[model samples]
Target: MHSSVIATQCTGAVISQRERQTDRDKEIVLQIRGHHIAKLDPLGISSADLDDKDPPELLYSHYAFEEADMDRIFKLPSTTFIGGKEKSLSLREILHRLENAYCRHIGVEFMFINSLEQCNWIRQKLESPGITELTNDEKRLILARLTRATGFEAFLARKWSSEKRFGLEGCEILIPAMKQVIDKSTELGVESIVMGMPHRGRLNVLANVCRKPLEQIFTQFAALESADDGSGDVKYHLGTYIERLNRVTNKNIRLAVVANPSHLEAVDPVVQGKTRAEQFYRGDGEGKKVMSIILHGDAAFAGQGIVYETFHLSDLPDYTTHGTIHIVANNQIGFTTDPRHSRSSPYCTAQPLFTTFTRTRLIHVYTPPSHALTVLSLACYHQSRQPHAISFSESLTLGHPVALIVLDEVCSHM
Candidate 1:
């Protein structure tokens, strides 16, 4: 054998080995993706048939590989919880971790983030087992918040059964979800949060989340003469400013829900402008001290033109509020149209967030109310870095007549 021939054979052998390793990595990545689809569609009526059957197995490998193979070949971090703590990697463990992260409650849509750093950060936060677990006290707090939200709506219905109050009926979870965002932002050193939302749940948000005075809100329900010089809008179309201490964070915080008119998405720019001004006044160049939270209706989020226009402002040097937390309270029905008819895109919020060059992270939550609140809190933690959007697409019970009208329209269309 010639020396040159030996060298060529050796090089060929090394190349073959590298190719095998690359093929193995690709297979593992595909398997990880399968974990996301393991469960049936929680909200889909079609999935009711599969409810009794065990969730179909997505991992074909059958957990045959050992721990060493996982660390060397999988490459992804381990988030498997065996005994309430993160454990070492294995083929079986990886499947468990991916299931907990992606399949259980929340389905995070951050693979399109474009930045490897951001993607990995989300994986770590969400993929890590026990990351979404809340303490007993925290769970109790959420329950209390939910109770207040439900009770307020119930009272309003009895008080004004025939009146046109755009109450938060089906999407009562939104109140606790918004509170979670505020609480998490406060923990991250945010002193002021400027929020904007449509009329669907403005009064509930005003009463519970903003902690507006009960007397002031009750007075608005009256049909008396205008207290202000100008003609007043509907109660739900109103906004309030409250500066109070966040008892949870023990920090003084300012909460302002910007008033929006019947034009559902017109307040988006106003919220951004308010957030940007606060950042400027406080010299929060990085938007650490001030942030914005914009809430949108599912139909308006996709159908409205201003939602896209406001997103374009996020990356502008002068107009950017560093990052804004967008929460879409998707009841799956528009003012008069169903989501299937109104939204061409899969997610109403996804298109607007990704249409611009801005790096926006979206989390599509399909969890129960309690788990939904916890997942929302995790989503808010990433907002200060860049714009983040969370869509809570859970089915809500619509008790109001207007929501019933929307539902009737949906059923008729069906």
Candidate 2:
């Protein structure tokens, strides 16, 4: 066996191997393509495709796509063809069409019409239009549908209270809190975010935070009777992904809400590990360009030992990921179990546990009507790269339970 053949088989290159040749057999040295193929394997050739004199088992390994390749794929223009002669339209005209289509689709005739009118007046310097093409009956139908889809009053009466057993007030508090995290992540330079929360007001958050199409939600609700295994999770467990342009950074950001199982805080560590790996691959060391935000149920955050295990891993050498922003969706009761029975902690689930770790701050937020605390908490977390816990405590009527916690722990050693 020639040394050149063995080198070529191992390294896919041609190089010299002096040890294989006998001291007396110098004249019989192997030569390939004008180079001394003593030990050196030929460069730029596969092992399997080597000349018949030195063929091997495996061939060329397929090259994988690099980051730049993925970016090119995503930015490729859509193949869907739009028919019509392309003509420039003013921003006002484009906005008018957009407003009309949005309102018409959502059945929010009055609000969209009012907004459109205001926009038209400002841009075109024209007075608001009088009653237009849509008749009173048609307007009523649109308004009724919009109310059914979005209005808090209708949401509470027919959907939230009836379907999920959550009050209108709770939905109001939860929706804004979810949205606040999404909006704040976008405001920062975070390219993508994933949220995990149990089934509470998952439907409301989907509609409001992720901006899922209302028609899709309605269709799911309508088909519940006929479909046994529909492509829908319970309103709270369903997940959504949205991409938006961050106004501050003038760059695009992706937001994802992970579908969580009923195992409660099980998803917390999974989300953290994933986000940290993603950030590292993207060259975001020590939370410079990426973030992981987790939403938790109050009882699960307190009672689940996984929550403590996850918190402990935040500062560990192998799994420390700068830290994740943890939000506790504290709804007071875990199904039927009250807070007293759920845990022995005084403050809520995440706050007391986080206090065990140094340099971790737990902020108790009392704002239910205003989502300012949630938004501010996220802002501070991203800016400081610290693990912070923002707990939202419910009102007296809501039993004064903790509503939400925002945890932002930074990797110290990194």
Cα-based TM-score, every candidate: 0.74, 0.48
Q: What is the C-alpha RMSD of each candidate to the true structure, in Å?
A: 11.4, 27.7
Looking at model 2, residue 249 earns an lDDT score of 49
Could you give candidate 2's per-residue lDDT for residues 324-368 as a string of tens digits? 666665444455454555566543534445544522434333221
RMSD (CA, Å), candidate 2 to true, equals 27.7
Q: What are the runs in model 1 whose C-alpha is more than 4 Å off?
A: 1-42, 45-87, 225-231, 352-356, 367-414
Given candidate 2, what's the lDDT at residue 61? 16
For candidate 1, the 10 contiguous residues with the lowest summed lDDT are 1-10
Looking at candidate 2, the ten consecutive residues that score lowest on lDDT are: 379-388
